[model samples]
Target chain A: MRTALCSLLDIEHPIVGFTPSEHVAAAISRAGGLGVLGCVRFNDPAELDEALTWLDGNTDGRPYGVDVVMPTRVPTEGTAADLDKLIPAGHRDFVESTLTKLGVPPLPDDDSPARDGVLGWLHSVARSHVEVALAHRPRLIANALGPPPPDVIEQAHAHGLVVAALAGRAAHARAQVASGVDLVVAQGYEAGGHTGEIASMVLVPEVVDEVGGSVPVLAAGGIGCGRQIAAALALGAAGVWMGSCWLTTEEYVIGTAMPALREALLAAGSSDTVRSRIYSGKPARLLRNRWTGAWEESGAPAPLPMPLQNLLVSEAHRRLMESGDPSVVPMPVGQIVGRMNDVRPVADVMATLVAEAGETLKRLGELHP
Target chain B: MRTALCSLLDIEHPIVGFTPSEHVAAAISRAGGLGVLGCVRFNDPAELDEALTWLDGNTDGRPYGVDVVMPTRVPTEGTAADLDKLIPAGHRDFVESTLTKLGVPPLPDDDSPARDGVLGWLHSVARSHVEVALAHRPRLIANALGPPPPDVIEQAHAHGLVVAALAGRAAHARAQVASGVDLVVAQGYEAGGHTGEIASMVLVPEVVDEVGGSVPVLAAGGIGCGRQIAAALALGAAGVWMGSCWLTTEEYVIGTAMPALREALLAAGSSDTVRSRIYSGKPARLLRNRWTGAWEESGAPAPLPMPLQNLLVSEAHRRLMESGDPSVVPMPVGQIVGRMNDVRPVADVMATLVAEAGETLKRLGELHP
Candidate 1:
């Protein structure tokens, strides 16, 4: 399973597991693959610092990375309070009404402030994430949207951290390389979260053709099993950058925080996902649930732009997660959902992926040996 | 580059070249790959019979296949004239107005009747295609939509011809195998013609897992180069079924029927395509042009059902073909259009695909060996 990426990233296998859970991140790195913790969910820098400290202690000296959501097309940046004002009343009403229709119960009123979802998406907060990540022993920092800002890239390099960017097209990959990123993750349309129109079959080779010698390219989107990993490598990707596959892992967000979401994901087929802007004002592949379906219905208010859209529906998303209704939450997942039918530990998943990929590569090699 | 598909199809490489042009098909078969000629373009049985007869003599005794567009959900079965009446006047007006806006002039008045595009999409006409194909020496008969209705399968089998069907999902492939088709073409969303939501990265492996040992799966969609062919085989497909790559071949249409279309295609990138229902009643990927863009605009009339949509726009399509305005024609193409930058002979394309696939497989085999 080793490739040029294994050498570059100093991992045993050429796999980068992406998850928001610190537990999963540590497990993946400990299992000899790079685990990238998604930092966008942590609106507070203190929380991210705490999570990184925990990852540092648990990964047994293995290398790991962190991912942040910094929009290439910079969105309106401000405090969450200032950003919330930009959301329209109609959009908020649609969310509330759609939640009522979906039978999602409201959260119990508490003195603790509601979780702010849009802050981390803004440029300022993402820079803070870069700062917090730099203070840790993380080996890499990845941007989910596109290339990180020039200053951010410079800062990461100064801290001896490798900068990686996600690109959906060859042109984007070239631009990311030109902007001084160390590597490119060619995330395709079938990938969960933010994605571009090209599929992995086309995007990976195109990106590799554009930047393979200059920088290693990791194939993302719709990659789960070992065969997919082999296919990605065969398409010229140095390694595989996987996210959706880890959502169902035992360490994913742990406990009851997203049991309903996991159940819905387990029951989904390959065609059960939809690419829409309803997730964060940017088009992302999400599980097709009532929450996503309602916004697509005729007469439904069009989703607002990023930051504002996430702000408007943050409470609705929270309530849906807590509602215990599997059919209502719009969780990000790839078309690989069809194969994720059971819960497994991160080590077991990594073991199976490495074993299968080795066997597949050996089998394919025999074809022309 | 050989696989089980080569043995089954009696070709040197596990590649299926699908083209609507008989010249391209014959050249492919002569070059040691299976060339499957698309039969849906020929509405009349006599014309198809004539073309297949020419193919029989030109292939140097090599085997080829024929593809027909038989909709699983049966459409209206009637004469072209009878079916034309069912198209809404508003839809006709929209097509005419769109043509005028695109600077597509009407064809010169001729004594011959107008070409009817929807007839071949109907059940009766496709069945006629099967009849004409069976009369020829084609080794395989493929249905584009789903499994040829059971009788069609039985008819092809009775004639000693293998039957193959295209599927976009695992379940669709299972159904095709259950319906007794010998092979399944797992076409993905990145493909040129009518496609489902799943992409080749996910769809190919899913289909192979569902029906691989039972029957070989031919991976299609976004497959243009030998590297993609290698990746498809790595993903468990027995072969690669290609369509868009042939559009830019020297023998694509012959003469000057589509010089402008070829130029536009050569200038296209991977992201320069959109999946829309404007081509047929079903969603198909088309080169992004002013014509497709116009239909996507607000207030544009919703495209009619399959047969009706084709009937309403058949004349417009013909006029656009003759108009020499490349930006107006909604040509079916995949994201692989990015790589099709030059026109070459079909033999050169076949040789490159075979050579590249062999090198790629050899390179991947070296990773572990």
Candidate 2:
């Protein structure tokens, strides 16, 4: 685990965990790996500020990172209200009809204004996230989609923070490196959230060969255990960036509307997930259920692009989550869900990964003999 | 490079080349790596026998192998003529109209019966390939589509020949191992010909973890260079099985109707190919061309199942090759085509792979220190 990445990030192990929970991130940082908090869910800057403030006080002064979803292609321009008008009536009808037909109930009548302006795919919304994250003493900031803007990278560097960008293609990795990103997270198709068509095995080595000389690459997608970490290093990746595996961690299990998220993942197999655009208007891998199937089956309308699609399904997702139906929950997960069969603590997961990878390396060392 | 595969296969290098040419296979075997001849092209048993006889005389007693496509799911049963009738008239019209619109000329008149009986996907045709290959003193016999039939595996083993099968999924690998396969080639999505959606990076380790203890696993798909071979080994592959890289060799460059195959491959990048069922009714990766575009564009008819789809486009491919048009040539290649940029001999390619892999291993060895 003591590779260049260990020294670069000043972490004991070359493993980076991505999660939305502050507790999981703190636990991972305390366990000697970099814990990156996914800040897209924090629509309000104050919420992100409070989360970062908590992270700053915790983790025994260890460094953590923040991930923002800043897609290169903004399908629509203007405010969220203006974007809402662009979503077609037919698409809205289909989403509502499908959810209603599936018997999904609506959320309880609470006075929260439906999370209107905080859609993370909006550049303006994500920019606020960067602002909130920089207010804290985090060491790294990663853009979830494509290369971050040149100014964003410069701003992060000016603040003494490393700027990392996720690339699903070798060309994207090269573009990110050219834009002065300090690190490239080469994500594969098997990964959750947004992804390209290329798989991790081919994408990692291709990106490593393309831009690895200039910037370190973190192998992502379907990375759950220690042997995969070893494999990533063999592919010339500096480390492994894992997100889906942490979703089932005990820290993540503590909060959230759906306690069945971990149970759904445990029950799923590698082929049980589908890459569909219904989640966020991008081809993201998610658990195959009525939602994904309805969007793909015959007579289903083509999903609206970007922010429009995300808006159409956001309320439905809220309802499904509140309903607590594991089958309909909007869980973004990777194919690695097939391997995450247990509910363990972050420390136990990290220890097992490190030990298994150490043993795998020792076994590989004996291959020649 | 000195893994158990070398001793098990009695080869100096744990690299295997898959090619349709007898010359390339013999050249590869003589260069210290096993060369598996793809027998799907030989519709007649006599043609395969003739090819094997030539290999026997040329290889200096080195071990070689044969590969036949025996798909688990047969789209339609019956003879080629019987299956030819099953192809819809609309698909035939589309193929003819698309090719004519592209201005592809007809094949030069030769006295052969237009190759009507030898559809590769048909099990009856593939079984003849097996019968012909068994008559030769080959070291291994591999089934391309799925696990070989029980009788096929039993027969191959009884002759002291190693039985191998390709798998794109972990479950497929496990099934192949359970069916008594001596080796499982984990072909990823980036591979040429037929492939699954799982990328080699994630798929290799998954398949390796699933079946490596039961039998050896060979990593295939996007493996064109030595560094890739090193990565494959790092992913726990016993050896590397490559197909697309050999398509650009000098031997392949000669005696092929389309002299531009190598040029096309050299001009291609990793993203230049697509996985479409237009070629074989199964989602096989191919260099994107006018043919692939015509089938996928708006108003295009959905491609029929296996033999029917293969039948729909066979004549058009023949005419394209005979006309020497690169745009319509049916070249099944992997994403590694981007890395294959030269016209070298089989021996030089093998030597460079061995040397490059050695250097990569040494470089990785320094990563810890």
Candidate 3:
């Protein structure tokens, strides 16, 4: 398990867990792997600071990373209110009608502050996140969508943090290397959230070839078990950056959505998911449910561009989550969900991956002998 | 290269090449690998018999195979003539208008018979092909689209030929195993021709797990070079089955279409391909040329169902190939086109894959040491 990536990140194994939960992140780091907390959900700088401070105290001096969503080109050019106005009326009508058709109940009439600002898809908000993340003692900072801006990469380097970018294509990996990234996370189309059409088997080696000897490459997408970890290393990746596998970890607390998500993932076959723009205005893999089916059905309106699409669906997602309907809840997961059948502790998951990978490596060595 | 699959197939290497040309197939077989001749184009039983006879004499006693496109579910339930009539007028009009709009000149009217019957999308024609192939001495028989019918599998076994099926999903692989397929080719979305949405990294292990020692699995899709082969074996595949890499081999003679096809492949990046139903009615990954782009552009008609779509585009494909126009040529390729930068002999390709995979395995071994 201790490869070059392990030495580079000072971890016992070359596995990095990406999660939104502080508990899972701290547990993975304490279990001898780097735990990267996804910070795109943290809109307020003070809240992000508090979360990092808590992680520092909980991890017992182990190193962890932070992941932010910062696209090189923001879809809309305006303030939050102005961007909200750019969403098409047809899309809103479709969302509302589909939810009504799905028999989703309306939210209770209570005065809660609008949670729109907390959804971070804007460049300004992500930049603020980078500012807060750099203020903390993290070993790595990764941008999920595209190459981090040059000044941000420079600033992160200046703060002695490794700058990482996720790319779904070889050309994008080259661009990230040119922009001075310390690591490139080559994700495949089967990955959850935003991904390009290239799969992990193709993208990893292409990105490794494109970057040449400049920076280490981390394989992402469709990586859950130990055999996949071994495959990633054989594809010339320095490590594996996994996110979907962590969703079912015992420490992953998604409030009311946990039970339904776990059940959906357990019941899902490999083909049970689809890549659609209904969730984020970009083609992201999500478990196929009534919500995704409604958007893809005939006569459904085309999803709007990002940020606007994210904003339009945010309310619907909230209502669905509150409704506790597993059939309609928005679950972003990778194709590897087919393998995530059980809810295990973070330490157990790490041990299984390491042990299985060790066994796979030994078996492969016997092939030549 | 001497894995269980190599011994099972009696090949020196575990590499299998799928090509439409009998010359390339014989060359690959002579190169100590299994060469499978794609027989979908040989709709006439006599023509297929002639081709297999040619392959037998040319391969120098090396064992070769035959691949047929026998989709488990026929899209249309009718005789060949009835299915031909089922093609809509709108699809024909769209194809003609698009080809004319692209300035492709009409074919010269020589008294050559309308060779349209040569295309085998109908179950009857594919069954005829299987009958013709079984009359020969092929070591293996493979179904490209789905599991071969149980009778077909039984007949192949009766003839002492190995039965293999290509699966894009784990469930499909399990179905094939249940149908008594001897080998499962777990193809990913990045594979050329018809493929499902699951990528190889996730699909291979899932398929392997599903079969659970019932049959060996061959990793397909995005496999071009040696490192990818190593990655496939690491993912627990017994061998590597490749199609797109052979399209650029020096012996691949598509007449005048070869130069333009090779140029397009060399210039393509990994993201330049899209999975579309324009070519074969099923979503197959193809190079993004003007032909594919026109079908997907705004105001374009949705592609018709399988045999209908294949019928509508057959004439257009013939004209494009005859015209030698690279921009509008219909080329079925995979994302691995990014790595097919040169046209080498079949022997050299095998040698490179073996050498590169050997080095990769050694490097992986050193990681543990």
Candidate 4:
């Protein structure tokens, strides 16, 4: 019932669910663990504010977090005024051409998505959002890319918000700790988006070793069960960060197409998931399907820089959602899909995971002579 | 120019170097694309000797084939007359102690200068050795377990042979794969080693995929290079049949590490290495190492059944060279690794791959534009 993770977040469970949907985020937070919304896709601070406002009503004061990717070095964030100047003609041309091929119509005029947004590449734009987001009463702020900039962490600390950064490898966790983030998430390759080489098992303990308890470590990637959550704690992770598991839940507003794709993947007990920059510019785990397949074919232009690629895919993402064709689509999830059997409600899933983990721990205790 | 794999046998190259050694099987064959070895470590087999031997000395004796295994099914070909009647008491006692303690002696046998005949796992046995190797006049028979199987494939095919296997994700080429083999080798995780999830760019396509395609798909993990192999074929793979590249490789080593590691894997990168024995009773790749570590640390009986638990790492294969040491390790090879960067080894690893393949008229090529 009690865990160090819960103590860190002041919640009942160490399960921190990462998602882009406000509905799912609120449900997870209300269920128990904090729900951190992925901020890579949000372009405007107002939009994030709206989502947070909705989350506020849904969570009823439960703790939640915001995840932003603050990459090591971003080109788009070059200067105060010349942010868009750095993108080259060829890259821009490639983006335009890619969108045409994917069938996503061009961005609408005044109704179009913002032109200056970072497109999930961890640009200066993401940092701006972080500043605006910290003003809210959210419990945590996580950097999904590299460590949060010193200013962001300092400001967050100043604002009384716990800071976290996602690490795919152990060294990254150490980097997060040294950078002064309050927590480090050991995100495994099984995770939905950007991740490092190490698995949760190897990665968690390694991160634990590297951080040496200076910061609480949350095990991300394939943590979808009570036993898995318990395992994260057992391996020294203060919390378990889950993403895909929540996407299939009842509250998720995403179409059945994506979940159906995930279900097909679940049946195979694994996925043909490969990390490609075809969707978002950075390497993110996605089901291996036609879009990625197209990128993989010979003579294809190598994916361009972050925001550019995101720019290219954004229209297509909308079109595909409208079309509901999975052959040309990818449902981004973690390797945990294999273990994520049937669909379950967020509350039931959380309860099952916790109860099963308790039993596993008890069984584990019984193992001792 | 002649090869046991090509003009003689039915394959396309004269280079036949079969190995459990990730580096050798990958290196030599990738070098010439004539590599064909054992898949036992990856999964169980149905008397591979016939197929292996059929491949032997075929390239008018250019060289070919490696025979391997974790062990067997039905009554194991070795041990007591009756199956269940045979649990060696001392062995059982040792296993019980080891399992209960969750302990394994450090690589003492490895450090020992006279570690001879200690026989790791099972490949050390003579009865099983001749059973397979003698059947094939392999250009080479790579035995990854230990002291190359007695009378190795080269000897049966009448010498002037090339025998090799791999060693280490750790140290570089040593008195290792070369001592028993004609070629000296080393495969980092970049290689698809025993579930090989190492890096080839770092490993190879470093060693060969590493320093020179001029070296050889004889290139490992991330190989089948044209530009890369053109970089590795230029570096090396006179011929290559890289297993994982072949699992996706134009061949079949299917159902081996599938259910255990690759099948359960969320993302398919050389980075997802979970060397656990939940498969083949050895610690192979079954997702992240953490998954297996749980079953391992559980108070279960130290795994049993060859290819059976060989898939789980829960037990050790008794009569097989691939088992033992706290449990059989997963027998997987790396894909060209990242250097596998591309997936066209069958065609790209060699200039010959395309031209020769083009000439074959397999009824399928006519369809390609």
Pick the lDDT winner.
1
- Write down the worst ten-residue block by lDDT for model 2 chain B: B111-120
Residue B353 of candidate 3: its Cα lDDT?
90
lDDT for model 1 comes to 0.89
Per-residue error for B229 in candidate 2, Å, reads: 1.9
Candidate 2 chain A lDDT trough over 10 residues, lowest sum:
A360-369
In the range B1-369, model 3's lDDT, one tens digit per residue, is: 578888889998888899999989999999988999999887577988998999989999999999988777876645546666877777778878988899888777982444363357778888888899888999999999888888889899999999999998888888888889999999998898898888899999988888948888999999988888888988889889999888888898866677777788878878888889988888988998888889888878888788777776777888877777778778888889888888899989989998888777777766663
Order of models, best TM-score first: 1, 3, 2, 4
**Candidate 2 residue lDDT tens string, A1-369:** 588788888888899899989899999999999999998887778988998999999898888999998889865766667778888888889888988888888666874665363377788888999988888998899999988888888899999998999998899889889999999999988898888877776778889989999989999997887778877887789999999999888888533564756667778877778889888777899888777888888889887788777777777877766666678777788888778888899999999998877766665555532
lDDT of 3 at B150: 83
- Candidate 2 clashing pairs, residues 3+ apart or interchain: A201-B201
Native contacts matched by each model: 0.78, 0.32, 0.67, 0.02
Q: Per-residue lDDT tens digits of candidate 1, residues B187-233?
A: 99999989888999999999999999799999999899988998999
lDDT of 4 by residue, B1-369 (tens): 232224433454433334443333444444554555664442223345544544443333444555443221222433222332444454345444644454433333443221121122344343354455555555444444333543554463364445454543312333333334444233333344343333322233224322222212243433332222221222123333344444333233332333233233323443544554444443344333333454555463555544333222223222111223213233344423222233333334445444433232221122112
| Model 1 ranges off by over 4 Å | none
Q: Is the docking of candidate 2 incorrect, acceptable, medium or high quality?
A: acceptable
Give the per-residue lDDT of model 2 (tens digit) for B154-219.
999999999999999999999888999999999988899899877777788889889999888999
